[model samples]
Target: MRRAAASVTIVTILLLLTGCWDRLPLRDLQMIDVIGIDQDEKEQGVTVDLIVTSLKGAGKGQGEPIAERTTLKGPSVIEAVGKTEYMDQGPFLAVNTRAFLMSESFASDKPVEEFKFLLHAPYTSINTPVIVYAGKMVELVNNKSSNRQAPIEKLHNFIKSLNSNGVINNISMHEFISSADEPLEDYPLPVVRYHESKFQIEGAMLFHSGRYAGKQITNEQLRMLMFMLGVDQGRQRITGSVSDSKSGLQDITYGFSVKNVRRSVHTQKGTDRLPMVTIRVRLNINVFDIGDNIDTLKPNYAVVMEKLLGKQFEQEAAGMIRTAQQANCDVLGIGKHIKAFHPKLWKSLDWRKDYPNITIAPKFDIQILNTDGFEQFQ
Candidate 1:
């Protein structure tokens, strides 16, 4: 009788545990791959663009689900997200979001405010990578142009290419959140634009605090910034113009295919009692292209060009450091070192003001290597 009673109790508990509850239908769950944010010029609000991949036929890479886009403009993020339910496309889900792209206006303005929805929203991953774009946010999120691959997959490949090529530094959503607060609040994100129906790195987007400090790093500056960040290894190609002394002020373009990059950095209190930082980069470069310059074929041109390149970068690095300081931005993240190793020093003064006056020393060692079938420029 005791055993039978115990069995009945267990059955009752099981029934209670399995009580009927509101559940989301599988067909109702839509997957969001990317979110693009742009400012509504007409209104004092933001336009949220979501790129969702239809999983109607998603399986084993055999067939592709269609890519659809939706946009909603609201004064706030939550309201905008809420308005999506009324759309004919149905309520969407961001749980499967792979990337987030924000426009210059949105990213630099109230970046934190723009993304706060993700923080409170259910099923959103904090690790989602954030990418910045200067072009039309809609054009970028519209990935239906390519028939070979889905837009999300193409964007993913672009990221891999960006990292491998060292176009600019990439940051994850979590990294931005982690550092967005403390001794280092400046976050530099990668930027891409739709060019020739393809995505290309435009530059690096700079932000101060949670708002835009009215600054951006792009073009040649972007390339130098990436190299200064010590991201010059792998199959990274450094392409830039260097003036040829023999060419009577004409600039010569050169492409250095870097096989390796070794870097070292240190921070200390200068004799002047200011933050002093030094960065040293040693690069093993394969001289790939020396455009319209006979000097590259010179017996000692490799050594000369290497030194010139190092010196040129030294000047370039100084300008970049100065620009960062003027903007009170710490893209290099040297503030962490000061806080970690010298707490007292960090506490003594305002880094924002002292940063501009801080001394930055950059030394680059460029070694030209010989590609067997090509030139012996090493």
Candidate 2:
């Protein structure tokens, strides 16, 4: 009787543990690797493209191309996602999705509040990479990778490379939301595009108060901004004409593989009227290249290089500021500086109205920390 009672208790426990009746087998569950969001041209709705990876021995390669893509449309993001089943599967699982690609049209449509809500879904992963493309999401996904890597992994690697190079800020869902709510700073999203059968970071999208404000900054402008923001790393090459005493309009190129970038912004109250913003940037550069042989390099090559770099930096800074001001956008975080130093004054002034009138004086101080292989010029 005791043995039977123990057996009965074990059977009851096993039955209780088997309550996960809704659990699908691994073979039955469809693992989604990528989700693409775009705007519907015909209807005022959102279209979702899902790239699903099947586990059924499709091939021997890992992340093999057994992936299937389907498009669904609906009035809202949730509805659009829910309607994804109409394309192929009766019902699909997306908890294993690796990335989300949002089309520029869909991203710039409105407040992006609905998208934010979709991000909070139980199946959505916070760490999943998000990319912004300009064309149809499906087309972007269909673009082939040159390296023979999976499309999703290729996109992930491209974004990661851009972030590591400090070419653009990482614009994840969390970062976007945080910047949108910030009263002093504008949110910048890294833009991706398919070119020449490969993915690239075109530039960054600047937003003011949750809306697309204007055109993106150029690649050079993005580099300069990265330097100003103290995030510049890797190599930056600047080539221009140096008016030599003898060689009239000589082509001189200077390559700086940056070691560090230190910057500071100071606002001064002038008696004349509007406050003046003074920006000082100190750069530690590794001199990697020069135009000609090091033996023929000028004695004042370092000084000339510094001057040329300074001019270039100044021009870039001025262009960035002018473009932002022209677009009625403040992306340089000038408001944050004011709030930090002059809280009372900032409170009294309306940044939106006063941004157009703000004056900025940028100063650059670049020093060559190491000459590396090009030390002959020194």
What TM-score fits each model?
A: 0.81, 0.80
Report the lDDT tens digits of candidate 2 across residue range 153-233. Answer: 677787777777777767665555455566555756677887666777777777776667766777677777777777765
lDDT of 1 by residue, 222-311 (tens): 666766677764476678788857534346688867777777787776798786789888878777675534433553666667777888
What's the CA error at residue 110 for candidate 1, in Å? 1.2
Window of ten residues with lowest summed lDDT in model 2: 369-378
lDDT for each of the candidates? Answer: 0.71, 0.69
Off by over 4 Å in 1: 1-28, 57-63, 86-95, 141-153, 244-252, 268-271, 290-299, 371-378
**Any residue pairs clashing in model 2, and if so which?**
none
Candidate 1 whole-model C-alpha lDDT, 0 to 1: 0.71
Highest-TM-score candidate: 1
Error of 2 at 168 (Å): 0.9
